[model samples]
Target: MRIGYWWRLAATALLGLASMSQASETAEAGNLVYTSGSQGSALHLGTRLDINVQGLQAQVRVAQRFQNTSSEWVNAAYVYPLAEDSAVSGLKMLVGERVIVGEIKEKAEARKTFEAAKASGKKATLVEQQRPNLFRQEVANIAPGEIIEVHLVYSQQVIYDAGEFRLRLPTTLTPRYIPGVSRAELLGSASVHTGASGWSLPTDQVEDAHLITPAQHHNTPGRLLNPMSLNLALNAGMPLAKVNSATHKLAIEKPAGAAQGVRSIQFAAGEVSMDRDIELSWLPEPQAAPVAAQFVSQWQGERYAQLMLMPPRELAEHQVLPRELILIVDTSGSMAGNSIEQARASSLLALNQLTERDRFNVIFFSSSTHTVFEQAVAATPANLASARQAIERMRADGGTEMHSALSRAFDHDSSGEHLQQIVFVTDGSVGNESALLTLIHRCLGDARLFTVAIGSAPNRFFMRRAAEFGRGSFTEIATADQVQERMAGLLSKLQKPVVANVQIDWPQPVEAFPRTVPDLYWGEPILVTAKLPPWPSRSDARVVITGESAGKPWQRELVLSAGEAPLADVGVPVLAQRFGREKIAFLEDEAYRAGNSEQARDTVLPVALQYQLMSRFTSLVAVDKTPSRPAQVTAKDGAIANAMPAGSGMQAVGYPQTANGLLWHLLMGALALVGLLVLNSRGVVYVRTEFTAAAGRS
Candidate 1:
């Protein structure tokens, strides 16, 4: 009977091979499969796949050709070929005893209920028993005739974390299976094989065979299977080797003379830990001398004098007056996950920071807008609690209609007579950044816009530009955990404007002038620096600065007398632009180079190199040839620490720590303890639990 079955299979395989050869020839000749119908149930193009199966092992090769018969360029859109139901149900990949993929679902009713829930807009959450190292989406951008190659390597098990996944390979097995072409086929069979390397154990000592199936794919009619399975044959005669339970590492010692009269032993390298250090620095160095005279000239006559305007240094010592503020929060679909959670927590923290004298309103926006308070309400406990409750109840949904949100935020009815301010918190994913800018141009007043960008990948350019256009400050909350700290720091800056509408005038023709100064947010002092023409001694340089104060105008003049001292010519404008451009370029380059490797290396590298060269403005310097390391980080703790010396319109501020780093250390220690327990159970170490009959013996 076995001989007859083998002969029958051989004949069937020969016929299949012959048909596959013809299909290959046709595919090589540039045959195309065009779109057939506009409606459903149409004969969409189909392709014949040639699969080679040998004793429970299979290799599949598919040659698909798509054509765009439509007038417009048709996207090769959706083309999915299903696998045989029974064969896939029993399939399993084995790395030791763990099944990486392919476990059939036992409960049909439960599966149907899950499918229903998923279809009904309920969240489909899947736990990762094993994670794959490379999770590739099968379909992306497929142009007409885009003959893409989709390849996958099945492994026994995989590991996963919150951000990444990992795959584990078997010791001595290459179990490859061919994916079938039928969308609905239950009865399926693959030829079985017994080779020295393919079998879980030596073929000579083969004992029992077990087939594993993917749990999610079992009995489910779907073209895509996440975890595929494999068949394994164990050696019964050979005693299962005792593996050390404490180590969590597999230990295998080969039988004597198993291979070429030599004994082989193997051990798994448990876990790996790595550390990476990042350093940031600058290019050229500037002189230590202050550029006060140069900054005065550039701001002599400007429309927004508040930006360059400076208050008395003594203001830091004085108590700031009570101000009214509005916090605009974006709770749209784009902010649905972690972003919305972070925004809510940050808003609550901001509310808590408000003093009794200050008044505030909280506005949440999705497709529509809602306010916690109609107008700015005093920072009373009752009002603040009400606002906090509203923020807590906010749910992320709907489209990102940002214009409507901004319009409501800047409406005259929302304004307060006392220091009016609007704090816009969002991930800034709106498509209409330009439109928002136009609106900001029209809404310019005493109100300043402070932006809090929340998310890993945020639209920094839009947020920064909006803040610039609205005469406010821009801040990024890089992580959900860091939202509260970053938002608080930003609010601290909005307490009072340090300088307003500052202007500078030069007596002699200065070599160059910095066109603009960075917006001086509250809690930050304003400092503008400029470069002077080559003076024949110090007497040839002088500049005048003018700006508005607390409802008043003021001016300041500085003189440079020509002397025997060495005159250092610093290009203040160039330095300022270099820093600004570098920041802007960083955001742009990161966006463009999101996933493309070659383009990022070719384009962003050169730009980053140039930025590294130009950032050295006396105070900060880049020591390494590479732009990765920053040599010295000056402390900006004091009031004047971040203040740009007279001529340079740039401030060197310290990167703030969002959360206490010490907390991470504690968390890591806990993880290490858990890892130790896992290792101990594997017999790598022994743990003793001591217990005594408490007072009975006494």
Candidate 2:
């Protein structure tokens, strides 16, 4: 009698789960079908970015305005990308006159708060991080013709290397490939985030495959979407000699009486489609170039400091060594157009750079791995010709099997006399980043890995993190024109170690991020952050950095008393936030490197909560106390689309989605309950995951 009652109760509770397929929306041109009962006019979203740069750090405010054109009420969502190191610190929702400020909360609590507000017919917003570089923002209860704007503020450090300070802002993402069997395939019963559907399902390796592999659609030239407005203000703290953008034309503003060190820049075209990221770089005055600098801030009675030090340019004498060179190329579908061309050009350049003393091999991967030679062979004329012909004939197709390629490249004997180096060229478009990074950490074995990021909008997070793990450097080549200039420099650097055995000595006891220092490459800087325990507030402390450059001991020092010159941007809160972000990243990397993520959540929670940061375990949520929608009116949910990344998959036949995120899994717990009840309350219960969709981007 008890079993019968439980069975009947389960069927009644999860009836919606059995009928969810009927609610699926038909495939609209580029709009992803993510929700049940999704109807009415199309939803639209507008974006604007305001960037402020001070010295080596930048803070950006991104506003996403969701416009509901139809008469029916709707809930809107969007998926977007930011710099990999961006520390999301603020979120606010604007409803006409009232600005609802968001508060940091545990991920589950934030979701609950948003859902409660949504059910109460109140306007609210929620922002969550899926990956370090990718985020999903949702606004609830947007009325017809209403413009609800969500403002997000994040901070990041600018890249200062090779004689310039550079920054990239991501606008669109590349659809990443998810590898592993579906949970259903492994267990005969699957757990999927049915609230949102994409081109993929949940896999064993990546439980959130549906979130990262957002649906994409063909973005024809005429029907481009997600236009953006950009504004930038630069304060170099010192006079600048040159400023320019590699991705867009800028209109430099020279206001009367403005200091030469401060400048305002705007997009010459005003508003542009969000098809790719914009990259800007600047060079400081030759006389004002800095070799060492430091920024410090305080939080909760403790002090935080970030330091940058560069070794002498002439510290290393270039010495060529016999090397075992391996060139691994990506022929994935994402590299179908200009991306493939640039990668091919880079491969050929690397092939020609190999000397007769080098033992070389070639690898190409897409869906599976392939090798030109089973083992490294002397770079003789015959081998060189064979490699050149194979590279030239490579075509882009299938999924990006990056792990297989790396395994094949690094699985050989490293005990040889030659210096072992692997040059991996790809768009870095795979979603299984932790798996690959962990693989490198385990099997690296005296082998150095260098990544050549090839694409107009490559995954910067993967490129930067992989190189850091491999104890190597990364170079980004955005176009065919940059192949020669960029590849030549990278190939040149691979010939010898720029700086190794890097170590830092602080004047006092401190806890630093990156617990371990990494090897520095040509034109690279040693950047670090730390927390200074309670101590005398003295200004005489010094930080000494030491590294081995060309078999010589190299040292540089920065006086902590000397803040940035001109006395501006010394104690900004963003510096502390940057430290918090780094610390959280360190915890994550350490946990990942250890091959276990179970403790990562608990380890990073304290830092994220104490610093009010948005992290993997924490989120930002805003709620309005007053109810704005009538109880009689029902609100439909829709996803606002993003522009397809420029020059990506130009020849691909089909595209699935182009936008942010809004999916409803009404069967959140009902299906799990049913599964348990049906199996005499002993079967595994799979709770539905959350909603999100976006490529792993810059």
Candidate 3:
């Protein structure tokens, strides 16, 4: 049976208040309705996903419908997931025939505007970013029995790896572990008792803990809580050897006698459950894989091009350098279920790959850190056995203190002849990404860091960015079955020499994003977007790329012509959007190292405003001019819960509880209990028995 959204929220809030005296105990025991079981709430959440893929890029539209099933005014809040690097360009609220468009404003200003409009009983929508991959949408004064739909559109460059092009749509997110001092010391600025769907308290580490920590519901067999539908159209431009989905079952259809190779794919089943990530992959035919592919368009008297350059295969080389591998694992409460199992298995596999020439150490961390050995040890039988036992004995509990573990891994001596490689194995469920990435950037020297993301809904944003900063690569293992296959490919890349010192030369002036090209891993291609000078002559323009593999230098060049070429595709805006995202990320990294400065704003805000993207300093908001709800009616806020990620346990309830959270609830409960006891002692409420009278009568 379906329940009303506001009614459920109201009930949760009342329960929350009543349990204030026993807050810590209730939290520890997982006694609340939202935290007690794995069953999903009766709240119906409907989602529709529309995707369009255009040669290495994807444009996506997601429409979420939230309906109020009860007879009370409710304020709805939903925290959802999107690709970390997505360039969000549009947000709209659908109300009957009115389409309210959202405008970009500074985050604080936008929040203030939305709050003011909401206080005036005007219908308003606010979209705020809690993490790069996580977002919260607020809809104020939703009337009883009202149905509201929010549409969000974003664009991103697709992932190309290991000869396959892949795209992933995260339907849900795993609960993240935020580590820091207790809530009493740092303290949160927001209310902790907001009727949010997830089991978590406001923490000192993550200020918006109430916003990000959502209630998670278990999925029962044959009963899916959140229903979602997806439709995808791929215009690969070249013949496809095969198209497949790694996560869900989908049907692929190719039109008969199609002019160009366009494949239409749809979910095989109807209304699939939003539990795991939806991953789709396709491979081009052996003959169709281009050595060099280029697309060009002209805008504002300047030329722009998106180019892909595939490096020639390397010949067998005899020399192989030894490595120093540091494997770091997370044993936080969030990793208590299938995630920990997968992490352990993946670590064991990684250990087996270490040869005698390599030396390694294992660091297991949760609230604390433990290293298998004080220093890196050679991969001998006894050391491997000890490492295996340590991994086997590890359990998930406590806080997610990642900084300590990371510091230990990166603080090693740098004068060793062995190549230092740190393999971080976790769900990437930490909230402090910017701080961690900054730490990596500062401490990383001659050491490469790779991220092995485990579990169903790991934070790919952190994993991907960490790898990018560490000059390594990132891979995800969503299910136990994929551990071997995915790990093998990753191991192979690690064994090979990476292509470094890449240089791209153009005949004329050109400005490119990254401004610096990253090292290319084995089986990967160099993809670059550049703003080029206008054609010098009617003749073709030459572009050359040079890189070093092992000790050998390799170069490739392509002559690009503006005229008389049928392959020219219009790619200005998408190219521009990609460039904008790259530049913003670079600025953010800089600001994280050195505090935010006017220089960053002068460089970033203009680009962000010009590109119409939401960032740390900016937000997207929409408001209705006419007041809908009456001023007499009080407004309340509630958070929508996300479904529990598959393979995870009931540990999602507000983990890493603080003394303040527990003692506050306890004090209230103790006072209430004392009042009840006094009333009983005074005979205010008494019970009488007729036992004496019955005995006398007998």
Candidate 2, 569-643: lDDT as tens digits? 332377678888999998888887998865699989888998789998999999999999999998776455555
- Cα lDDT, all candidates: 0.37, 0.74, 0.71
lDDT of 2 at 668: 25
Top candidate (TM-score): 2
For model 1 the TM-score comes to: 0.39
Q: Pick the winner on TM-score between candidates 1 and 2.
A: 2
Q: Which stretches of candidate 2 lie over 4 Å from their true place?
A: 1-38, 184-195, 222-224, 315-318, 534-539, 562-572, 650-698
Clashing pairs in 3: 4-70, 20-665, 21-665, 21-669, 38-218, 197-215, 198-214, 198-215, 199-654, 200-654
TM-score of each: 0.39, 0.87, 0.85
Question: Going through the candidates in order, what is the number of backbone clashes in each?
Answer: 58, 11, 10
lDDT order of candidates, best first?
A: 2, 3, 1
Per-residue lDDT of 495-516 in model 1, one digit per residue for the tens? 6655567666766654232344
Give the runs in model 3 whose Cα sits over 4 Å from its true position.
1-44, 182-204, 298-301, 538-540, 560-572, 595-602, 654-698
Q: Model 2 — TM-score against the truth?
A: 0.87
